[model samples]
Target: MIRTGILNPAVLSLLARVRHTNTVVVADRGFPLWPQIETVDLSLVDDVPTVRQVLDAILPQYVIGRIFAEEEFRQVNSPSVVEALRDHTGAIPLVFEPHVEFKRRVPHAIGLIRTGDSTPYANLILESA
Candidate 1:
């Protein structure tokens, strides 16, 4: 039995298979479910386990090379949510693209983690290092 690090079996299994340069998305509640991509739905309730909460849990287990977000994230999401993401990311560079373009890239990610955050455009794409 696993004693520590991402307790969710599905999440752990997905992360275990992630390779360098692979993409994983940690997205908000409203993010579309792509039929072609594997999705790990973690949303229990509105804002129950937020994007930041999941990111904090996953950050230690993965070596992330870069992060991608919707260009409107700053203007649409709460300041606290944005700040929390920035704090967790630290030195990792954040690359922003239009929401349409961001969604276009989701199908290519190895996995998409759906969080309970209600904030608008609170999605993030992490590239494994």
Candidate 2:
């Protein structure tokens, strides 16, 4: 009967469980899987649904306090890609660290959503407000 907003049941369930300061990861298609953390694989094809595309769907429903990403994202991806992501993030503070440190934070996230984005280092961890 529900016909609007986030329609994916798995994604809705995952968002429902998030609390203040809890983290949720939106990773690219190539991001490594963590057996210990729950994941919703939304990947349809290579670059079919980008990480930004998923974020667009979740941003209105989720309260993101901060975003964490790899410093290398800006270095590896085009300037337009970086700017596009920044525009989507709006006022949310974005912090960048080394790739290793970024991965270390993944296990603590409430859940991860894997996207079909092929962009290198396109992964991001959003901490709930």
Candidate 3:
């Protein structure tokens, strides 16, 4: 049995399958579900396991190359969310795209892990390193 890191079997298995350059989305609860892409829904309740919580668990397990966020994230989300994102990402450069364009790219992601964060525009696309 796994003792550390992400204990969720589905999430662990999905992380193992992701390859370099592959895109995985850590999305907020309200993000649209794409039928063509695999979704690992981890949302329990409002702000249960937040986007920061999931990222903290996953970042150590995966080598992320690039992080993408909606252009409106700064405007829509709380300052704490932004600070948490910065704290976790550190040196990783953040790229911002329009929400429409961000949604347009969702179908191309290998998977989306939904979190219970109620913050608007909290979704992020992580490109595997």
Using TM-score as the measure, which candidate wins? 2
- Give the least accurate 10-residue stretch of model 3, judged by summed lDDT: 76-85
* lDDT per residue (tens digit) for residues 19-126 in model 1: 989999999899887888889999999997888899899989899999999989988767886787788889988888998998887888999999998988889999
Alpha-carbon deviation at 1 in model 2, angstroms: 2.0
Best by lDDT: 2
Q: Which stretch of 10 consecutive residues in model 1 shows the poorest summed lDDT? A: 76-85
The whole-model lDDT of each prediction reads: 0.89, 0.95, 0.88
Ranked by lDDT from best down, the candidates are: 2, 1, 3
In the predicted model 3, the residue pairs found to clash are none
Model 3, stretches more than 4 Å misplaced? 78-80
Question: What C-alpha lDDT, on a 0 to 100 scale, does residue 27 get in candidate 3?
Answer: 94
Writing each residue's lDDT as its tens digit, candidate 2 over 2-117 gives 68998999999999999999999999999998999999999999997899999999999999999999999999989998999899999999999999999999999999999999
Candidate closer to the true structure by TM-score (higher is better), 1 or 2: 2
| TM-score ranking of the models | 2, 3, 1
Candidate 3 RMSD computed on C-alpha atoms after optimal superposition onto the true structure: 1.2
